[model samples]
Target: MSSDAPVGARPPAGKTFFGHPRALSTLFLTEMWERFSFYGMRAILVLYLTAAVADGGLDLGESSANAVYGTYNAMVYLMALPGGWVADRLIGARRSVLWGGVVIAAGHYVMAIPTGWSVFAGMALIVLGTGLLKPNISTMVGDLYERDSPRRDAGFSIFYMGINLGAFIAPLITGFLGERINWHLGFGAAAVGMTFGVLQYVLGRRNLGDAGARPADPLLGADRRRALTRIGVATVILLAVLLVLLVAGWFTVDTVVNLLTVVTVLVTVGYFARILTDREISGTERSRMKAYVWLFLFAASFWLIYDQAGSVLNIFAADRTDRSLGGFTFPASWLQSVNPILIIIGAPLAAALWLKLGHRVSTPTKFAVGLVLNGLSFVLMAAAAQAAVGGDLVSPLWLVAVYAIQVAGELSLSPVGLSATTKLAPVKYASQMLGLWFLATAVGDAIGGQVARLADTWSQPVYFLTFGLASVVLGLAAVMFTRQIRHLMAGIH
Candidate 1:
């Protein structure tokens, strides 16, 4: 009903691209540029934080840097709750995407301004921007395809590849600029990427016009006006309260920030459960949503270990690994590119492997395999930690191997989960459902950051081994529940 077409009707011809709507390209490039900005900033984030005070960093100790890392990563996902809600109820996906791009561009530009407050302001803006863009973009992709279209999975796969392509290359360019020249230059480059995305989207509006139309209502303009009025008042009150809290200092910076984060997560989860209980969602749809919850748990577990590429692993590369190769010093920031590079190489092969085995294996079973593989990546990391403790430089091969394994794990679950979201989600609350999917990732990353902090408390080997063991246990338990979860997917395929 939200679509441009009448119920059960089809679009006109000449809009097809590789078996999907041509608009997929517009969405693809839009996501590509957005991710380029995001990952470009991500590549330099830890290095910027952990750099010595003389080099323009805050001179924060390892603990402070990792804590900020955790908090920042958590907030990126947390913001998606309101982002999804705003798109569903008011702005629609097109406007939300545009607004998110503007905010992100401004955030990156703010980081280029060169001040301590600029860093805080930039981070807040990026968090809000990502929440707005990330979920809405993917939901728009699903909207381009009709329900039960076989091309839907492949479309998501293609879109996901665009994400990796941006992620893979951004770090190499931005990381080099940040490390070799100026950190702000790298941030400036990210701003340019976002700006380009925004411009492309506005120019290509016709291609995406059908993808994010406002929902139709019998009351028409009256309904629209009432909704806008309500949202405007809510926004004004929320901003005023936040400004007051900041002035009063009744909440310390960290406490108030994290408290707002907790409130966001709880409210989002409650909304999704309410949807699950609604009469509009059929019994099969509820079962599939429940299955999604399990998949969410599985994903959260993987990210808990996987997100360390930025924090704990960044530390390992900087402090323990020898960057020397003959007379050349490898830039520490460049090391962040390893996982994305591996994703580029391994994602295709993993997809092929899944295609070969998909008929024989269920999705939950494949997800279990992904968890086990992810755990093994950390087992290798633990071995690297052991080598470091003994004063031996870890072979770069160990890092490459770990990255390869993690990418393999990612390929197993990431595309499957994206496709499952579209299949399982009821058409009415499509963006909201995907928002919950992303919220799971946010929760996972937050918990992972906390777990990554264990490296600061105990020995690195203990931290690594504990995560590995937890993955193995959770993976097996997930495998045990596969039959029940698969029952939920009965009508979806």
Candidate 2:
């Protein structure tokens, strides 16, 4: 994408961003900073909310805090649908990415102020900013490489590391400031992170020449005005409904959770129906769509379980897991770093294992195995819960091992799912299919919020064991039907 170079020329002959294009350095650093800000805030949001008001918190209570946290996560992903649409149509991904960074930085600064109401404003801005930035920035990463370029996978792997790196370090930096020093300081740190990202991106973007500089489908002037008008009407209708609910005294945490759950189900069903009924697809494409539906089911199930790491598991780490290291106690948010650390260590090993086994295994078989591993992680957690006899503190290794194993499950299914989506989706609906993939995560996350509520109602053993059994049963079912699903894939493997 370098503007100064001739077409097809490689990034300047000198040092590259880890042997890839120089454009990668810009996008990589930008994403790293964005993720740092995002995860840093999430690390302590619930804790800050539940703390006493005198301690610089809103005192929202545990249930309410969890509700807000879960809903915020769900909304972040949900907004991506429209964000991607906007980037693809009205605005180029390039400008959208830049403006989104500004919005996200503003959001962080908003949270840094010392006021309770500021939290809502901050979250709203962050959600909107993230929706605009997250997916589009990722799209830019692919622009750094040419189609069939051998360096493409390696470039992405490097980009993936940047993501985990930010996630790994965010809690460490913000958790200390937010939990130990001051809450606003923590948020301010996140603001600083984004500021750094934005400044660097402004300086380095020339390497990414025309990549994402133009919208794939640009809108006409009247069409743009009509789109804005429709958006305005939708926003008014949404606000009116919320106002009515508030006036009726029905705007509670449970209400939001329940509403999102129903909405998620509707969205999931609608996506599947849209693809299956598309008359433009060939017979083979239709069969592959069926396979994709099955893939969505398994992917959603894994996400429902995996998404708990940042929510329910976070709470458990704070309240139940012992954070002491021989008289020195650490921040509970430190535990969030474990999975990324595991990913850093395990990603290469997992990739190697897959490469070695590729000739011997099928993608569906690998997915089924991933599902089974996810089930086992829960089973281990269930046992850990059972072993908390007489309220004794369980070893931190219990949580560590569970997180480690969950990463294994993620490695097995997640990358395969991404590849499969591109391979199996009808060409006409390429980007939509990717959006649908993101939607699966949103649905899982919304349902996860509902499931997290059970922490208050059910015994630990009961909750863990039940979910564990469900996961295992689902995995077994996937295993049994692997061949059927693979057949539907119609040579995609």
Candidate 3:
């Protein structure tokens, strides 16, 4: 029953969602509930990991928990590369999204089981599912408009709002359920959210005219058989290696995390090498790709600090922040809601600001702004950590202010980076470029997870200040290279 129209074909002129295609509403809601499930579980993951065993938790140490959080995130994003490949060469974006949603829902339901092993098993499934779902859905969003359509950015802006709205609401509900009630129940709620997403996506498929109807580049006959065989062999080899490690007693959590971090970095280097050395791309495109490398580093740096909201900062919120209001103490996870709400409020304003500024401001300059603001947020966190030195609880407002600043930085860089990725991508690698963008986050979270171990060994103030200042210095350095980067960008704005 799926439409077989070519990709990017406009939907039949009928009812619309805010003057765009009706299908946008479908994709928007699907992404919204998917994010709801994601952020809901994320709000409580670290807290659940580090809580007392008596409190129905794993009771993992702080450093280990943070490391797990970072690795899990890295894996989720890292999978995007293969996920994109699958969509392009096998199932197409439409089916990938549907199957991904089902797997995600199943993963959350698995976590709802009250067992020590279930959480890790559930996280593995979610990582695979998210890998399939995330990038393809965004690709579908892009497919809704023709290339170079003015409405393309506006459509993505609306879609971005959906993401924030879900994120804004999820922590409030899941934080209360997980922290004040049973952690499993919170996971169950996330499962329900994803189920709703899946059901609605199925129901709304008709609205999607031809967007992601089939693979962009399908492998045929012998090629398909060969590809499947190779995938099977690789999976078997990976499993065999893991089994050997487990049998040899070297299959520790930290070891696995460290190994994956290295793998993520190597993959990034390889991907960049493949793109840069491709003889097919024109000189102008190659120049733009070179500029993209700088932006990628800037984005990776931004996420390294920004993504800690769910790990290191989440722990600080639980242990050091005062959540008491009148007679009742609020859950620490509730504070995680701050950044998204601010994003929801600030995104439009930032968009308008960018529109007004027009070509006067370059992408590198915007990225530098994001980097500086991200560092300043951490610098502020350093002060907050210092205040909590003697076991004194700081006001919840400190975290709020921190998240607000981070949101501003996110606004400055994230959307800009996405736009830049599309603009700079070589024509042949267009579909895979989004996956490369996600890899930046994978690199940051992977390395940042390792870096976060320092928090366990160093004073809180020192830890925050060190990374904070380092980011600020990197941002300033980026500013110095702005003109050079723009020159490398060739004609891209």
- Highest-scoring model, TM-score: 3
How well does model 2 score by local distance difference test?
Answer: 0.82
Q: What is the C-alpha local distance difference test score of each model?
A: 0.76, 0.82, 0.90
lDDT of 2 by residue, 1-493 (tens): 1111113423333347778878888898999999999999998888888778888887776666666777778778877878888887888778888988999999999999999877778988998998888888877777666666788789889988989999999999999899888888999999999999999999988788766777767788999999989999999998998899899999876686678668767877987888789899888999999998888888888888887877767777777777899898888888888988899999899889989987477777777877888888888888888777467677778989999889999999988887788889887787777777777788777777777778667887778778877887888898889889989999878
The full ranking of all candidates by TM-score, starting with the best, is: 3, 2, 1
Tell me which residue pairs clash in candidate 2. Answer: 1-209
lDDT of 1 by residue, 1-493 (tens): 1222223333323576677787888788889999899889887887787788778776656665675777688788878877776776667667888889999999999998877677778988998888888877876776776766777778877887788778877887888788778888888888998899889888877876466654222224788688778879988998888888778886454455466546646765786678788998777778787888788889878877888787888778777888888988776666777877777677778778878876687778878988998999898898889989967777666777888888888888876776677678876776456566666677777666556656878888888888887897888888999888888876554
TM-scores for all predictions: 0.87, 0.93, 0.96
Query: Worst lDDT window (10 residues) for model 2?
Result: 1-10
The numbered model that scores best in lDDT is 3
Q: Flag regions of model 3 displaced more than 4 Å.
A: 1-13
Provide backbone clash counts, one per model: 0, 1, 0
Please estimate how well model 3 matches the true structure, expressed as its whole-model Cα lDDT: 0.90
Model 3, span 1-493: residue lDDT tens = 1112235455435679999989899999999999999999999999999999999999988898888888888999999889888988999889999999999999999999999989988999999999899888887887777776788878888998899899989999999999988999999999999999999999999988888888877899999999999999999999999999999999988888899999999999999999999999999989999999999999999989999999999999999999999989999999999998898889889989999999999999999999999999999999999999999999999999999999999999998998888788888787678789899999999988888888888999999999999999999999999999999999888
| Residue runs of model 1 more than 4 Å from their true location after superposition | 1-25, 139-155, 206-226, 233-237, 240-253, 279-284, 390-392, 426-431, 487-493
